[model samples]
Target: MDPNANKYLLFNKLSSQDAKKKLESETFKRTTLSFYKYVNLKDISFYRDYLYREWDKLKVLGRVYIATEGINAQISIPNYNIEKFKEQLDNDIYLKNISLKEAIEEKDFSFFKLIIKIKKRIVADGLNEIDFDSSKVGNHLSAGEWNDAIDKGAVIVDMRNHYESEIGHFKNAILPQSETFKQELPMVKELLSENKNDKILLYCTGGIRCEKASAYLKHNGFRDVNQLHGGIIDYKKQLMENPKLENKFIGKNFVFDERLSEKISEKVISFCHQCGSKCDMHINCKNMSCNLLFIQCKKCKEKFKSCCSTECKKIIDLSENEQKILRQGSINKNRFNSHRIIN
Candidate 1:
């Protein structure tokens, strides 16, 4: 057996569609969970390869980002092998006893295949790593403490994108309009410029973004910085485990998965982008050439055929060859961010 031959098997060979088919044919259930750590990794590739090999053996499938700063992962593991997977983590030097936040609304196929990639940072804030110490993050708060802080008039800031906060967030959170974490950090600072001395609470989909955000705030001289210990996912888990705690969060919690978003509360705080009807369901435009992501009600979904605009709808209606011709060297300025612009 040649070592290089086995090295070629490190990556997933199956296409996403085939991987989905294989996932559907599986008989066992899988659990979706997420975790992140800001520990230094000297050899990122070595660890990445190690994780891919080990997790592939356990039939784990999901997205994982590894950087010199840390690792951020959202993965689905086979229920039968979950214990063994946990054992594997426990044995690992870097990830031992790391906190894991299970998905609140888990689907059998949250992800189709495993994908581990190296990145510059686990959660990109665009801030120089040397400028801020990520380890000096804000004070961690539990669900009960978070509610108490809210009741006490602490400044609540949603660390996620504008689209995420549009669907659901803690009531009265200072939701920044920026679309990415890199833009949100400075926007958040400006949004709370006067509240530097005030108690500020930050949170994201998982705790990873907040970990960086809280540190950034602290570095920028914000006093009394705090964050949801495990972000919204863990907050929901805490709420489920303890009903006495008040659920300050409203509407659906937007997620980066096939399910799109999970119900955190019964309230629908957002409306469809097209008809303005009450809806929190998000979907990417069906037109591969212009995959704009936006909220669409069932009616609008059927009417538009999952396209974001009439122009996109016309393009999708064209023959395959015609569509190909249009796609050739075509520049879609509104490919992802301009759903509102095109609409």
Candidate 2:
């Protein structure tokens, strides 16, 4: 879709100050929520257009993806439009009974503009329906049930990538070292190769990844499998409601938003990738060509000017034209360890 076609998205390269000013001017509280469903939809194009037109009127702002397999959305709807939005969703059989996860911390500016795109798959598990039996998946555990299962010594595994789990994760959970959910599945299965029959627990940022992962594990002949119903976001809400509940997860829960993460606990399980200091502050490199998402401590932020490495920091001194010229021919250096480069 042509984003520029919309008046709301006419501006570009806006400063945070400008963005905050716009957000502050808004009168209503924006509720952030996400939901997904794995159902066949042959008319995805029509469905996409229908959603865009409907949500646009409600002045929604967030990212949404729909595919033949399913729909996944994380968006901010106006407080007044909450019931209307829910009603609209309920009106559609495809979206009916979908598990919508509300954000614990409702920031009005979770998104700047709305964007709904059509994709090949909602979650991109890198596997077709033929690869696994989604019909018979793992057990869904509530926050209370999840804690109980963990206490019972079930083998807990984090389904999120290393970058996400590095900052915050359920304590004593087996964290896979892979970068994507596609890679993490096999990594996790191999990691727990010995515990096929044992009660295996899985979780992700949202519960969606676990849905696919659990199904895959079950297809591979793992008898007992379970997933946290709403993932960490729901788990945090449960802890907040009942202060007496034990929060095994620590540090910030990495989120895909302007905030980057939300503070779930006091512990910092990760460190600054540059200075090796204990920190959970995730920052993208200031260099446009090397926007590597890595953890940086306060001191390192000051030291490197929010860049991932010394080379990236130096790149900022060059003219924009020069930087672009350099970026044109080279692969993204951030994908590899920038700090480890001998140059």
Candidate 3:
């Protein structure tokens, strides 16, 4: 797919129906929800084709992945079509009655297109079947219970990647100094090796990854292992139910979609890497050739013009033809590996 082609989707930002004539004619209101299930599928291509055709007709949008292991999805649906969407999933044996995490703030349109791709693993932990057993999953804990465990000195471990954890995490949560999800398991086991009897609580963006991860910890001799049921999304919902526990989670939850990250509280836990100022905003490199992830302060954003580095800034100024030739075959060459701002 050409990077400049209409291969991507855009959504969000809308005016009230009464405020604009263009918006007044729109009838549907969208809701963003995510769900995942780990099941052995006989034919993934068949399932993929079936879902793409069905969902595209329903005007659903978001990225979805299917593998022999299972399926992971983040999708937006029109409010009136919610029942129809649920019925569609319920009709499938593997996805029937699955718990879906609803977003706190609903956007106009969360996604502009539907993308379903086949991959080796749903969450990209890079672990083979022998490495972890998805069948013997972890103990699921609700928000109040999770808070109780934290107070009782449970070793809270953030199960997300470093960049995701940078924006928000539980207070004093032990973050593995890892850039990828694949690195979290062994590193977490090593960190909690001494406290085998201590309650080890794990959490991730959605509850998908930790479902297997917590099981992996118990397999490694961690006696008391538990996980945040439904992960941060569920926690946020529980927090809304009880205003007293508002401060439990400290920062924004980094999302993979267009919202980028969702704010849980007003507190800012991360700083702009370039200016050393308090800012948790994450942006991709403006250099189309190198879309490195970095945090740029509003001041630095204006100064650097959203480029990751001086070299990238110069590259961004190049002519379209010159940039195209330079970028040829660079997509798979790992040019942005060293430029990742997360430690």
Task: State the displacement of the C-alpha of residue 285, model 1, in Å, after optimal TM-score superposition.
Answer: 0.2
Across 191-303, the per-residue lDDT of candidate 3 in tens digits comes to 88898988889999889989878878877787888999989999999999998874578989988776678888889999988878999988887776677777778888888
Q: For residues 1-343, what per-residue lDDT tens digits would candidate 2 score against the true structure? A: 8766764432224565675677678987888887878888778888888888888788777788899888989888888998888888889878887878888775426777677889987877788777667767789987888999989999999998888888899989998877778888888889989999899999888888998999999988899999998889989988899888898888888777656678889887877776677888777778878777787889988988988778888988899888998788663643323322111
**lDDT at position 179, candidate 3:** 77
**Model 2 pairs whose backbones collide:** none
| Stretches > 4 Å off in candidate 1 | 1-4, 329-342
Q: Candidate 1, after superposition: displacement of residue 286 in Å?
A: 0.2
Q: What value does the lDDT take at residue 56 in candidate 3?
A: 70
TM-score, one value per model: 0.94, 0.88, 0.87
Where does model 3 exceed 4 Å of error? Answer: 1-27, 107-109, 332-339
Error of 3 at 115 (Å): 0.8
Clashing pairs in 3: none
Higher-TM-score candidate of 1 and 2: 1
Candidate 1 collision pairs: none
